[model samples]
Target: MNIRKMADSGNDFLAETDSPLGLGESGKPIPSSPRVLSILSSVFERSIQKNEKLLKKLKTKDNVTVFHGSRAPTMGIGQYIDRISKYTCCGTPCLVVAYIYIERYLQKMDAYLTSLNVHRLLITSIMVAAKFNDAGCHNNTFFARVGGVSTKEMNRMEIEFLSNLDFRLHVTADIFRAHCLQLQKEGFGENPINHRPSNKTRAKCLPQIAGYTCRAV
Candidate 1:
């Protein structure tokens, strides 16, 4: 799978699937950290639940693909996103790019995005996106620490994700703006970043069973 070919393919599919929460400095104000956190929490939870339910059905049919990984997500999605925002250096745009990468992975692999894979996927995608978009990006080891995974595991997942994406990381201006617009439409436009949830609140908000530990086979 060539990156060129994949990019040439209409990413209208992205518009159809989960759109990004928002990005850049234009659309509406960059959402406040709390608002961005809320949007990401909802998006991650929805994707995880949707995929987990799908996995259960596939398991019944003996058709589930064993995702090779080990992950123990101590932080809830919001907290994780907050950490990612700090570590990735690419900030909100990286999150937007990560969301786009997730969409691409789902389309290319024909795989469900369950809790088993979402954490690793999010970490890897954000790292990759930061490298692509940010002027000064952290190394994979640093991101791994922030993401609660080993450097080796992160490297492996990064390779797997890039392979699955056919190495396509380019987000055209149009596609990027479209995702931001969708995110704004989804209610992230103009929320101030002043109000962040406490650790207790985040813990309460995260699903009790949200954490997963995946080690590469």
Candidate 2:
């Protein structure tokens, strides 16, 4: 979709809730909007629940996965993602692109987005998104600190994430639009991937996570 390029041409591609926060001095969107953060965190919460249900049915845990984490970290999804934005000041569009990267990895790899793996995957995806969508970006060492992982582990995770998705990180316009629509719908709980709170429903849904009161500027 060339998200960075789209910023200058106009936001014909973005939904009402997500476009404004992505704007930067160079025409790129700033770090992120609270609404987008709330929405994506909700989606991740659903993913965790769905995977847990599947695990229950299989009668086994599902921690046998890739990425660099040895155990699930103490931070919850909302806090962790909020931390990433605060530290890196990543553009809001990069967050969407990062979600795209996560979707690509899940669609291609035999992996699930559980707590143990989701954080690492998220950091890796966002890192990739920043590198791809922005003219300049933070190095892996900085991202490792943002993600609460060791630098070496961060490097390993970046390699594995690219490898698992076969380096297919580019998001086309159609795909990007479709994802935004689905995420918006999912956020509003009109037809969510999982059933739960829909405080993000500007139509009435993702209860904005606490402490995320400011946009990443």
Candidate 3:
């Protein structure tokens, strides 16, 4: 399937069937990390290629340089995400939160997500999201090894990432739902989620999803 095209087609009925899991709907389980990671990875790959072309012409670094590795890591971004999920078991909410943070930082910095910097940025953002959202999370050293970075660099990256975002990590329920909506829009194409969530008829979240850090397990 064309991963990039998933975001383009307006009626992705098949993808939508299971894609909207973990939106705190009754009987639906937490979203699958592999499925969400596939979508996120496709977006990252497209962004890197698009930014690569743009940077070649512009030839300027700006804040992007801070995240750039000494050289690009050999592992594919999808595989790297898989490895992190496999070992850390931080789950889909953390991955989605990391996505939100990455976009937030990019907007703040106007930085391009290039191949040289994407992996490092992802590792840092995911680590921060894990700490913020997960009950028991790994330390910087464990995350560093998962991302193929050193403990020292991981420490530096975490501080730098937090500093760049001004350490604002509290994602509210509405904001989280909006992000989930956007993720669904990408997977099922951009009609924009029209169904207003009702406190009216839905069952209470199995583990309480609103106004908290999305621990719906």
Candidate 4:
């Protein structure tokens, strides 16, 4: 068995330390530490529950179609839309803005892909947005890690999305300005160093903006 231990801000203790168990600890159960046991139990329980939920969801027709299509499919419109929405909602206003970009790009291409699949566009939008905002943070590995898709998968999706939208990236100027205005109105000063707007103020303002945006749309 391989044991790996990482110490807090210190050198990692990958090798096993001398056992404090009996001289001959053979066949005797070494009781687990309460904290360790609690953590392990919680992790196991969560994993089991997550797997169970996934299994149950996969049994459904829609989800089964998505999972199967994810592996191999030319294109299923409904499944594509579903995946887009699911992935996009996984982030914040920045993500929402990215979603808008995807939609506009698609619209400009004369691709009548339904607004229903606006979600999938979000994932690509986020990648584009992240790249636009900070190239350092927008890499294949970064997308793979954050998006929970393999680098190959992300690349494929990116190409497909771009092709569908005729390679025209249309990130709106309005969303960022709107968010900034809202933050300023709420007395959240922009960070001078990073130039990133405050998330706390944005969170507070999101509901109001969403309602207004929805009404206008």
Best by lDDT: 2
What clash count goes with each model? 11, 11, 0, 4
Compose the digit string of candidate 1's lDDT tens values, residues 1-217: 2222222232332221122222222332122244545676677787778767876777742123323344434556666776666444443455666888888987887776765566677878888887775545678877777777778888878888888888988887667657655664565454544443334322211212232333433
- RMSD, each candidate, Å? 8.8, 7.9, 11.3, 21.4
* Residue pairs with backbone atoms closer than 3 Å in model 3 (clashes): none
What's the residue-level lDDT of 29 in candidate 4?
18
- Deviation in angstroms for 29 in model 2? 2.2
lDDT of 2 by residue, 27-139 (tens): 64555666567788989999889987898899986545556355667688888887787667775677878998998888887667877678878888999888876666778
Tens-digit lDDT track of model 4 for 1-217: 0000101111211101122110012422122122221222233234335654665676732212111222322333333322332322222333334544554664565432322223234345667654554434347545544444456766766776666556655443444445324323332232222222223211111111111010001
Candidate 4 ranges beyond 4 A from true positions: 1-93, 105-120, 170-217
Query: What is the C-alpha local distance difference test score of candidate 3?
Result: 0.63
Name the candidate, 1 or 4, with the larger lDDT value.
1
Q: Indicate the TM-score of model 1.
A: 0.67
Candidate 3 C-alpha lDDT tens digits along 13-123:
222224343332342323334456667787889788888888778986545455786566777888777666655665456676788899999888888888778888888
